[model samples]
Target: MRRGRVLGALLPLLLLATGCGIRSTDVVEVGDPATVEVAPGAQQGTVLYFISSSSPGGLLPVVRQVDDPSATSSSGTGDDGRSRGKQLALLFMGPSRAERKGGLRSELPMSSDQVSVTTGQEGIRVRLASGVNQLSELARQQLICTVAYERGQGTTVTVLGTDGSIGPARCSV
Candidate 1:
């Protein structure tokens, strides 16, 4: 009985001691995450997230039809011929003029031209000129959520900055 009590007490402490270091993260709500599927019933457009005027700091997704009818691939690339880098470039382009009038805007500190992309089993890795600490958490959230929606809900995305790296993180929303 005594040993069981000790073990039980330690268990809660052990659970509390283990964490990813971030004590808490705000779940930036956007609507349902957009999943780009480029197979036989794939969506014929790309979804880009931007900050909305009404929702101050929240992300708003904007779907733009790609020239390619097949749209994107399940592997996070586009069968439409837009690779991950090209997709990221489109993100850097910001929302369209009509979108801006509707209140969608980007939070990225730099353009896609400032970053390089690579993909493997670990997921997509984006290298940036800014340091990990240099980016605001909101900016990081924007990147993570966009990648998560693009690649799939559970897909892991990592950003490597000149000073450091952030994530192998997934957006819960």
Candidate 2:
């Protein structure tokens, strides 16, 4: 009778231990995830990617306060949500004095004037006034990474090089 009582007492506990706490039902739909929407009129910080030894891809992001493009330009009317050319201009400015001292660098291999970056319904495009093919792979990665960060979504950038050749670059990392 004692062994029967002990076995009966332990059986329920063992059953509970073997079962998951969530024994109720099928997969639950929690609806969509929340998203952060930036107000168009607000001053937004632009993200620029510079080369850094400590970063995962050697591309480090530095945020600088910029006048909100959506608030300032007609191009902002579209869903693209950013001023690509303007951000590229900022990227061309490279890392700030403090950033450089901290070991951030750039391998863009072109001046701001040498490249024209634009975005539209078709997507972000970069036209090189000079050499695009001549750019080293690292330099290309720097450009690709900056544009991807600026554009969001890690999308590809189509380059219109001076050689009348156009190609697309996507971030491998």
Candidate 3:
């Protein structure tokens, strides 16, 4: 009877502990900040920025640059120039769209051993670790950053590296 009682008591504690799982919801609207999708194939050598979404009346129509292999070849540039490094920026609005209204404004900055990035009005940041070849794959391997935003909330942003590995970070915001 004692053994049964102890096991029963521990069962509730285990259930309670396991029931506390972390979840996240993106508040930003779509098509505002503009989403930038970087597939593993698209990443070459240069850093890339992806805008998941932005607030209204915010900065629209951002310009992103990607290095062209053909241009480098024609110009006879060195290997650095020839490298498939590319940068992508997106413009969220056109001339007419700029006239629209604005939405809530917030900012989230992310930094890691590998790279540092600042996000706008989301209260979230993602930093990459150095010597990372695959980000997506690393997401499943380790805790990367400590996210700070919502109290009693723990979150994590996993980067999909070029090689298919997920980069690590700890997020609580």
Candidate 4:
């Protein structure tokens, strides 16, 4: 009788601890898929690109479309538009492997002509310049000026400077 009484006393506590009695809700759809819409009067061209501090060379050609903002084009805007040129080069020179792997690296600063330069703990903040889409002529100019002014010796940096300067910077890595 004592054993039966103990079992009865533990049964309610065991049930509460199991959490099996909790109710669940059904999954429901929340929103529709995203779509890209192109604007009018956009120009098409290719831009050379590279990522900084990356090994094995990250240089490539990228195509971009400049929206005229008044044309009747129906393509996607900004990053979603189709390329008129070749591959888009991407360069990355963030924290080094040692810094990332060992967790001892500091953030670096960056900026371009299109964007104002701002300093932060990790590095400089960059924003898109006005009337610029992708790495075009104007973008290239701003990037060149910004890099020339902000980088330091022994720092891993990547840039698409005018006059074929990208080759040397990439080789430095």
Candidate 5:
């Protein structure tokens, strides 16, 4: 009888504890029901891939406010790359003055004109004026991350060299 009373008391407690197992964080809600709409475009700032000062082999992604394209007068837009090519051009230009002061560097070629970008159904193709195999691993990574950041994470990018060599790579960032 005593055992029965003990179990009866513990049963309710056990049931109560199990009922509270669900956490507020366990549920995920997606999409907003509101009618408010916003324009789709590049964020006010841009992301550029550079070489880390401490680790020369690694890539350092930096976000900076968008500058006037005409100030430098590049080709592609930020990342969208529809109107003008800013992100890729700025990346090829290497780290900005402020960025260099902050200890970031770039392995990309000195001449930004040597690089060209074309978007196709297969994805964006980065045509390098030099041989793709000539690029160091760090340089290749720097190019991949920068273009991928603009195109979208994990997007397919083909690097074409002037020698008619084509290399396939994906953005791991």
Candidate 6:
């Protein structure tokens, strides 16, 4: 009888100390995805064009961040040509310090202020002070890829010179 009383008392003490049969509940609320607003031009990253070290003179597209808001174009809407113009300006500026360290370089002429890009119904139209036909194959590829990426991939693009149409190319990458 004494042993039975001790055993029963010990069981209750164990349950009380262990918090047995107690339940915990927590509730959290999350924001709605549909209501989120993202501005295209105000984005934090840059889509820069560079020459590839591995491909033996191929264009390498690098999407990295920039501190300056003016470093890239806000051309996602395809309504304004100024966005494309901004992107072209960045292209002509050449590779960043980090990119040069990584073996990237720009083939496009740094002094070509006459190069301008505009969006149209068909695709992007690039006006070059220099003849489009004069551009090296790799240089042309750099222009095509950079403009295409900003305008939209797979979009058709044409190069024009003061003389006339240079050629038509697509942004395949």
Worst 10 residues of 6 by lDDT: 33-42
- State which candidate, 3 or 6, has the greater TM-score: 6
Which structure is stronger by lDDT: 3 or 6? 6
Q: Which is superior by TM-score, 1 or 5?
A: 5
C-alpha TM-scores of all predictions = 0.61, 0.69, 0.19, 0.21, 0.63, 0.64
| Whole-model Cα lDDT of every candidate shown, in order | 0.67, 0.66, 0.30, 0.32, 0.67, 0.70
Indicate the residue-level lDDT of 98 in model 3: 27
lDDT of 6 by residue, 1-173 (tens): 99999999899999988889797668666776565322243366657667887755477777656676444656355445565666677788888798889888887888546666766677778887765566777777788887776555677889887667745787544
Candidate 4 global CA lDDT score: 0.32
Residues 1-173, model 5: lDDT tens digits = 99999999999999888886775566578888776322222355556678885754477777755665333223344433432245667777888898899889887777756556777777778876677777777888777776766555667778887666444677654
| Per-residue lDDT over 17-84 for candidate 2, one digit per residue giving the tens place of the 0 to 100 score | 87856566889999999987432322456666678899777676666666664522223344332455
Tens-digit lDDT string for candidate 4 (53-113): 3424322222223344222122332222112111111112223354346332212223323
- Candidate 4 vs candidate 6, TM-score winner: 6
Model 5, residue 146: distance off in Å is 1.4
Q: What residue runs in model 6 are displaced by over 4 Å at the alpha carbon?
A: 1-42, 68-71
Off by over 4 Å in 5: 1-42, 53-57, 69-86, 164-166
Q: In model 5, what lDDT does residue 89 have?
A: 72
